[model samples]
Structures are given as C-alpha cells and as structure tokens.
Target chain A: MALFTEAFLTALLAGAISAGIPLLLVGLGEQMSEKSGVLNIGIEGMMLAGAYTGFLIAWKTESMGLGFLAGAGGGMFVALFMAVLCVRLGLNQIVIGISLTLGAEGATAILHYFQFSRTYPRLPATLKWDIPFLHDIPVVGPALFGREPIVYFALFLVSVFAYLYRRTHFGLALQAAGDKPAALDSSGVDVLKVRAVAVLTTGALAGLGGAFMAIVGAGIFVPFMTHGNGFIGIVLAMLARGRPLWVLGGATLFGACLSLTTALQVAGIDIPTDVIQMLPFAAVMVVLIVLGSKANLPVSLGTAYARGER
Target chain B: MTSEMAIAPDSGENERKSRLNMRDDRLHFLIITIGPVLATLVIASFILMAMGVSPLDYYGYIFQRGMLSPSGVQATLTRMGPLLLIAASLIVCFRAGIWNLGGDAQFILGAVFVAAAGPELVAILPVWLMLLLCLSIGAAAGAVWSLVPAFLRAYQGINEIITTMMMTFLGGSLANVLVKLVFLDPETTVPQTRTLAVSDRLPRLFDTTVSSGVLLGLAAVLIVHFTMNRTAFGLRLRIVGANAKAAVHAGLPVATLTVIVFSLSAGLAGLAGAVAVLGQTGNVRADWNPAYTLTIVPLVFLARFNGFATIAFVFLFSVLSIGSESAARRLGVPNYFTLVTMATLLILMAVAEMIDQRRRKRKEV
Candidate 1:
C-alpha cells in the first residue's frame, strides 16, 4: 500500500510523457505559426479536428498510423481556414481563431454525439517500440525509451526545428514573414504563401499531436479532449522565445506538474483535489509572468499583413 | 445657412456630408449584420440536408417555438437576462480592443459567491437588502478575479489573453472547490450551494415567469452604450484601445484605462453570473460551467460591438439556442448542431467584415 514504489514512479513518469507529448507537438506547431507571424489561435480547433478525424478513422480502419495521418490532415483542413481568412483575406487573427475553435468544438461535438456518443468505441492500447538496453534501465528508461515511435519523432523534431530556424533560407523567409513582411516581399518572396504554409504546417503538427492524445494517450476520442493543451502549446512557444528546445522543456515541465497533481490526488493527500488540479495552470501563469517579459516575441504576431498599409 | 457657412467656411458642406455618411452607415450596417445570418442559414441548411434532417422543419420549429409562442418567448427572454449582460461586458472590452475571454470563469466565481452567501443573508436580512448584497458580491468576485490579469497586462506588458484564460482554469477549479468544500448544503445529498426559495430570488416581472434580470441586462447594455459613446471617459478608453502609443503620446492614462476596461467588462460578466443564478437557477452546483463566454463572443462580434445591434443579436441567439434544443429532440439531430450553425455564422460574419473593410479602404483611397 506504500506509495512511490518503482511501479508507481514508473507509471507517474509514463503519465508525464503521455500528457507532455500532445503539448510538445502542439507547441512545436504553434512555434511554426508564430514564426511566420500568423498567431494561429485556432490551434485548439485544429487539435480538436485532428482528434475527431484521427479517432474516427483509426476506429474504423483499426490502424493507429492512419489515425495519426488523418489527425494531421484534419488539423490542416481547419488550418486552411486560418490560411484563407486570416492570411489571405487579412482578417483579424484572434477573432477568427476563437471562432474557429468554437466552430471546431461544435462540429466535433455534434459528430461525436452522432457517431460515438451512443457507441463509445475505444481502441486497444497503443503499441510502443522498446529500445533494447535503454528501456530496461528503470522508470526513466521505460518512460522515455519504450514510448510509441512517434514520441521519438516528436523529440527529434526539436533538433530539426532548431536547425531549420538557424540554417535554412526558408527559415529566414519565415522569420521575415513574421518580423518584416514588407521587407520579405521586397526580396521577391510571397509573404502570404510562406505564412499559409507555416499555418498549414502548424495545423498538421497540432492535429498529429491531438491524434496522439486520442490514440496513444487515451485510446478514445471525446469532445474537448484537448483540454487547453493547444493554448498551453501557444504559451510554450511564446515563453520559449522562439527556441524549439525550450518548448520541449516547457512542455515537459508542464507535463511534470500535471503528473504531480495526479500523483498527489492518487496518494490521498489530505487536501482538496480541485486545489491540486489548479497547480499546472497556476504554474504556467507564474512562469509566463516571470519570463513573459524576457520572451522576445514576433513583431507582427497578431496583426494582419497587407500591401502599402501600416 | 450663408451666415453659418461664412462663420465656418466648410460647415454646410461638412453637415451635408455627415448626413449622407450617416445614411450610408445605416445601409452598410444592415448589409454587414443581416448578410452573415442569412448566409449561415443557407450553408447550415445544406449541411442539415446532407445529414438527413429537414432544414425547413428546423427553421420552422425555431420560428414557431422561439419567436411565435408566448412561453417560448418567455424562456428566450429569461435566457437573455444573463446573455445580454455578458454581451455588454464583451462589447465593452472588444471596443477597448481587449479580449476578455475569462468571462466564463469570472461568471462562475461570481455566481458561486452569491449562491453561497444568498441563502445565509436571506435568513436575517430583508429580501431587497439581501438581493442587493448578493448582486454586489457577485460583481465584486468577478472584478477581483480579473484584477490580476489586468495588472499583468497593464504593468508587465503580458498578454491578457493567456493570463485571463489561465485565471479561468484556476477560477473554475476554485469555484468547484468552494462549492464542494465550503458551501456544501447539508440538507441535500448533492454537492451544491444552499438554494434560496424562488420567492426570495429576483422578483418576477409583471407576474410572469421572466425574472427582473432582463431589465438589468437591458439597462446594462444601454448604460454601457451611452457611457462608451456619449462620454469623455469612454472616448479616452476608446483612444487607448485604438492606439495605446498614441494615447500615451497624448498624455492619456493608457495603463489605467486598460485596467479599467478589464474590471468593467469582468464586473459586467460577474453581474451576469449573479443574474442567471438569482433570476433562474438560484444556486450553483459542482463543476457547473455553462461556458457562455465563447458562444457570446461571436454574438457580440456579429453585433459589430454596437449595443443596439447586440441587443437584437442576443435576442436572435437566444431564439436560435432555445429552438434548436427542441428541434434536435424532435428531429433526432444532436443539440450540438446549433453550435455548428453558430460557427458557420461567425465565419460568414468574418468574411462579410473582411469584404466591408475592403470596400471602406477602397472608398478611402
């Protein structure tokens, strides 16, 4: 009956990974959007779209791989709206984003009510690939090394993004798209196209992250299952100061805090569970307050881009 | 007229131009406002047809039940009591160019505080005094909840969006905690605040089922519209919202105005919470969050932040919401479909707004 056993600790660490992966994927996608100055407030809606489509397809097809793909596709479909309205039409990013999220929420809820609300089909546990020596080392080993193959891909994306931001010409265009669209345009580049691509990429990434939540994390889809993970992704991206690894770190820390909350409640702490549940959100706020000032954000983050207008 | 023109050479021209502009604005407002609504209906009808539900039946049901029937009209008006207050709060903030997304959280906290305090106060105090105290508590709780995010935004240059949303999550959890732990009514097995008797709650208007909260909502929106349009303080806030840098250059208290906007909007939201509880539910339960904020965001936007237009929109929204529920029951369509309808309307509204903006820009050019 004692707490903090090897099994207990392992489960806790595993829970952290399960919770953190969606944030990682979402944060990385939001990073891409922010980098191109789109803000992409529809991250939550995109995630919901991904989750719904990902779960529906996976359940019907009985393939987690296909589910993740559908999730990405679903996210991109919603993101296309962002690309069209906010990027192409020069609409208010924040307004469209909130509306998109609400739309997605409503759309997904109705879909669920029709298809899954009555039936409530759940997928089997997600298959994980165990790394030979590393996965056997202990709690950290099993938690980190024995994750689904996508976890490794998600972790590796940080490095890839870092290199992309630092090395590529496209990266410069993306940066310029966000920071100085007029200058980027002057250089004979299509700023809108770059932004659209960035937003689409963001949608795909967010969708995939959402699919991971349903397929790997919960093995089921429910309305509002993303549960503000998309917003946290935005926060992580913002607080990371345009650094990919920092998003990983922030997501991890938030995940760790979430796990601690779960662990405390499970341990029968002599306190209200709701108070414990508030920790992660409160922690994020504290982090944002302390570091938000120092986080150098995009210059044209929320503003719509246009020709010959300030 | 000649003397007036002689005194100020362009006065006649300016007056004529303004009169013409006012007419143009009215036309533009009608096109912009009603255009998206019709578009949403058309688009949603196609989706409904695809889903095997009769679009005619759906719209017919909404029209008959929500608009035509007296009881349905009462329910819609009852629903509007809180909705209008929230809309007022949103219009205020959006006008000041701030997003007050934390309305749901502020609302819940306010309602919870009032629900906890209302029953206790009614025992000792007169009905009028108790109701007044409860309303004040609700407003105070909501304002207090927003203070932190407002300070963060005004002082530290933090985005109120993140801070306010974060506060919402925390506030929701805190509300549940307060209900379950502190205010648990011992008389009932359910975890809820002690409910006041219906007689002790907000008085019924004209001996009808509708609560007096509707009057409060109407008053609030009108007061806000007048204050924001016809007053210097509102103009200052609008200036700060329009361009903070310009306001600062002009020696306006931009930071303080920002804080005021947050509080005023949040206070209205809290007042909404109080109205809903006092006028209808009479108490809060654990995990009781209606999340009217996000839904109302589109409604306020559809109204173009104009109070009069928002009143009409809120009424339409309540009708849509109330009618959709019964229609869903009759047609076997999920109730969530109304949200789909709303989302479509919101998008179309954005498109219309975009087009309108383009037309304005071209006109300016």
Candidate 2:
C-alpha cells in the first residue's frame, strides 16, 4: 500500500534509462549535424525508418546485432534524401527535413500494414548485462548498471563525443564548416563533404536509437513509434550547442520527467492521463525558452554550403 | 529565428519576388510544376503493381468514383473546405519564410473549442450568427495556441520548428482532455461533443450535398493569393521572407512580421477546423486527430506556395483521397498509399525545383 516502494522507485529509474538512451543517441547525432551546420530535422524520419527496419530484421534474423545494423542502415537510407536534396542540390533544409519525415511515416506505415499488422508479433524481453559489484547497489545499481549493453555504449559515447568535439582536428573542421564554410573551403576542406558526413552519421545514430526503442524498449514496432523523440533530440542538440555532456544532461532530465509522468499517473493523480502525459513536452518547451536565447549556435546552421555564395 | 532559409536556395541574393514577378519561361515553369505529379503517379502505380493491384483498375476506379460520380464530387468538395483553408494558411507561412507545422494541433484546438461552444450559442443566437461566432472562436483559439511559439521564435531566436512541434504534442494531449472530460455531452451514448442537426450545419450549395464551407475555403486561398502577390503589405512580408536581415536593415519590423505570419497562418488553420466542424464533421469526437495538416504541407509545396496553383492541387488531392479510400476498399490495399504518393510527390517536387534552378543558371551562363 506504500506509494513509493523501493521496487517502484527502481522500476521508475530503470524506465528513465530505457527512455534516456534513445534520446542520448539521437541528441548526440543531432549535435554533430548542427555542428556541421545542417539542422537535420529529418532525424524523426530516420528514427522511424530504423524502428521499422530494425524490428523487421530482428524478427526475421532473431539477432539483435543485425537488427540494430539494419535500423542504422534504414536511417541512412532516409538520410540519403536529405544529403542529396538539401546538401547536394541546395534546397530548403526545414522543408526537406519535414518532407522526409512525412515520407518515412507513410512508407513505414505501409510496410507495417503489409508485413506485421496481422500478427502483431513482439520480441522477447531484452537481455541485461550485470556489471560486477556495481549492479548490487540496490535501486541505483540495478537501474543504472544492470542494463543492456547498448545503454553502457550510449553512455560511453557521451565521453567519446566530448573528446571528439574538443580535441580532434575533424571536430575543428566541423566547427569551421558550421561557423564559416568559406574559411574551411579556403583551408582545402570540402565543406559540403563535412556537412554530408555529419548528416549521415546523424542518421545512423538516430536510426540506432529507433532500433533500441523497438528491440529493447518496446519489443515491438508500430508505425510512428519514434513519435517525437527525433524532434526532442533536435532540441537536445540545439541546447547542447557543441557539448555532448550537456546533451546527456538535457536528455536525462527529459527521461526523468517522463518517468515522473508515469509515477504521477501510478500514484492515482486526479488529472486526466492525457494531461499528465504533457509533462515531458511541456518541460522541453520550458527548457528551450529559458536556455535558448543564450545558447551559442552555428552561424551557418540550416544553410546549404554553396561555394562562392555569400 | 534563424536566417538559414535566405531565398531557399536562391544563391544568397536579395531580390524582389512575387507570383507576378516570377520570371520562369513557360516551358521551364510547366515542366517544374507538372513533372513531380506525373512522376509521383508513375511511382505510385509501380507500388500498386507490386501489391498485385492493376494500375489501370486503380486509376479507373479513382476517376469514376472520385470525379465522375455525383456523390463522390460532393464529398470531394466537402473535403476541400478544410484543405483549401489550410493551403491558404501554409501559403501565408511559407511566404513569410516561417514554418508553422503546428497546423494539426491548431486545427484540433479550434475544432474542439467550436464543438464545445456551438451548441450553447445556437440555442440563444441565430444559426448564421452562431456559425460566425464559432468560426471566430476557433480562429482565436488557434492564434492563442500559436502565441507562445511565435513569441519564442520572434523575440528569443529559438526555432519555431522545435517550439511549434512541441506545442503540437501538447495541443493533441490537451484537446483529448477537453473532449473526453470537459466537453463530454452526457446525453450522448459515446463520449463526444454535442452534435448539431444537419440543418443547423453550413447550408449546402443550391440543393447539392456540398457544404457552403467550400466557398469560404476557396475565397480564403484566393484572397491570400491576391493579397500576397498584389498588396504593399504582401510585398513587405515577402521582403521579410526573402531576407530578414535585409528587411530589418530596411527598417521593417521583422519580429512583428514573424508573429503576424504565425497568427495569420495558424488563424487560418483554426478557421479550417471551424469550417470542418461547422460544415462537415458537426462534432468533435474523443481521440480524433484527422492529421489533414501534413497532407496539406506537401500540397502547398508542390504548388510552390502559389495560391491559384494550390487551389488546383487541393481539388486534385480531395479527389485522390476520396478515390483512394474506395480503391483501397475494393483492391484490398491499405488506404495509406495516398500518403505515400503525396510524400513521393513532395520529394520529386524538390528534385524538380533543383533541376529548374540548374537550368536557369545554365541559361544565364
């Protein structure tokens, strides 16, 4: 009859990690894209593509690894459109980004309707890897350490990205590509190439996030399953500026808010569940408004890099 | 909030532009405009073939039921009421270089508000007066929902795409709350807003089944076209769209224009919702989000944000949607194919624009 049992709190924290990992991956990818000056709004579509293909492949092969690969590949496939249209052809980034998402939604829905709508098959439970000594620390350990390998890898990626942005030459080129493509071009780097690679990498990460959502988080793929996670990732990336650690912080905060929503509902809160569900989105909006004005942004963000064009 | 869309691939040059001032040659313009639609049909036919549905049969059925039949024509016209208004809304936003993808949320908010209020007002006021008030309420609700995102984007330099989308998620959830709890009609068997009688709805056109809301939608798009293309205000907005920095340097109120763009576009979208509730749906049901906005996004883009062209595309889309539903029923294929086709058309539209731009540059060379 206790409202906040130890087990309940552990499950809540575990759910936070389950949700945060996808946002973390997506935000990391989106950060790289923004750093390279492409807004990359199509991450939503990429995530959906990954979720569908990831679920389909995992179901067919019964291999989680291959499923994640297919998910990433599917995202890259959608990103190809962004690369060609927005980057290569110099089109509107926002319009193309939105169109790609719409396209992915329709395509995935059709594929799902034809392939899996009848059986509604779901995967088995996600396997967890218990870290020695760490996972025994009661609720915190089980929630943070005794989880899927991808969760650890996603966390590791935060540090990797931190090092990538602050130390590497490629990171400087990326910064140059976003801040001043002309300077990067004068220095003999192809600005378009840098931006293109960044976008494609974004697709892979977003796709993997989608795959994780399906194979590990939900164990099933429905059309539009990614929901607004991709958009949320964009928010995270924008807020992070160029800091992967900040992205992690923002994403975790969002994930914790999601858990809080579930907890409030479970506690028999009088408000409608629909109203309760608005917390994460409302939280993200408030965060964006409060921190957005002061966040440093890429000068060339959302613009196509056309040589010799001011 | 960002100046990244400067001329949308216009090579960073600030130039005066409008429907009247577009300098494309007729052949180039025709190819760019018509190419994507035909290509989309061809690709969609291939998809149909893969599904074992004969393309000929599908096309034949769509044409017969959606266009050649009386009842279908009436239905298509009724569908156009909301779509045409949305097209107008999109034209306004795109013209100002602001993206308002929150149409779905705005539309839902507008429709739910009107549905919740209409019955009470119709009891006290004349039908015509009630309808006007309901539509106004819908528009005001939509504009109000848009204010936060508009303010954030205009004053704070945050992207509206993120803010608008976040608001959309909120709007959907909030509308469900309003409909399921606050607006539930106790007299109804199901949890839904109270419905008005058919006679209380927008009157049909001259004994036909088509609602008079179609005229409102059509007139709105036309007015947008004339105003955006012909008026000094339209020119100022276009100047902001083409180059916000230039507009600012020219002493235009850039932030105000951006907010006005949001209010006008979202207001029209809300009006579309009002028209639908007033003319077609009659009531807001629990968990009903028709998602007509995303479909209209591609349509406006394929129309290149032009008003007259948008009118033509809306009619075609209405027919396609009506026909596709029946075709999907008969062919045992899912009806989502219409969305796939629209999405393909959108991609092709971008490709076509790219080709047109390349050809223009080559000609100049």
TM-score of each: 0.94, 0.94
Candidate 2 ranges beyond 4 A from true positions: A264-271, A288-295, B6-24
Q: What is candidate 1's lDDT per residue for A79-146, written digit by digit as tens?
A: 99999999999876766888889889889988888666666788988888999999889888998999
The per-model DockQ list reads 0.49, 0.56
Candidate 1 docking quality: incorrect, acceptable, medium or high: acceptable
lDDT of each residue in B1-365, candidate 2, tens digit only: 35555344333342343233456555666787688878888998999898888988888888999999999999999999999998999889888889788999999999999999899999999999999899999999899999999998889877777788888889999999999989999998777999978888888999899999999999999999989878999988888888788999999999998999999999999999898999998999988998888778767876777787899889988999999998878887778787777678777887888877777679657
Clashes of 2: 0
Whole-model lDDT values for every prediction: 0.86, 0.86
List, residue by residue over A1-310, the lDDT tens digit for candidate 2: 6768777778778878888989999999999999998988789999999999999999999988899999999999999889888888878786688788888988898899887665679998877899999989988999998998889989999999899889999999999999999999999999888889998999999999999999999999888889789988987887777899998998887787777666655655556678766888898787777776755778888888888887
Off by over 4 Å in 1: A265-272, A289-295, B1-18, B363-365
Q: What's chain A's TM-score in each predicted model?
A: 0.95, 0.94
> Quality of candidate 2's docking, in CAPRI categories?
medium
Each model's backbone clash number: 0, 0
Q: Pick the DockQ winner.
A: 2
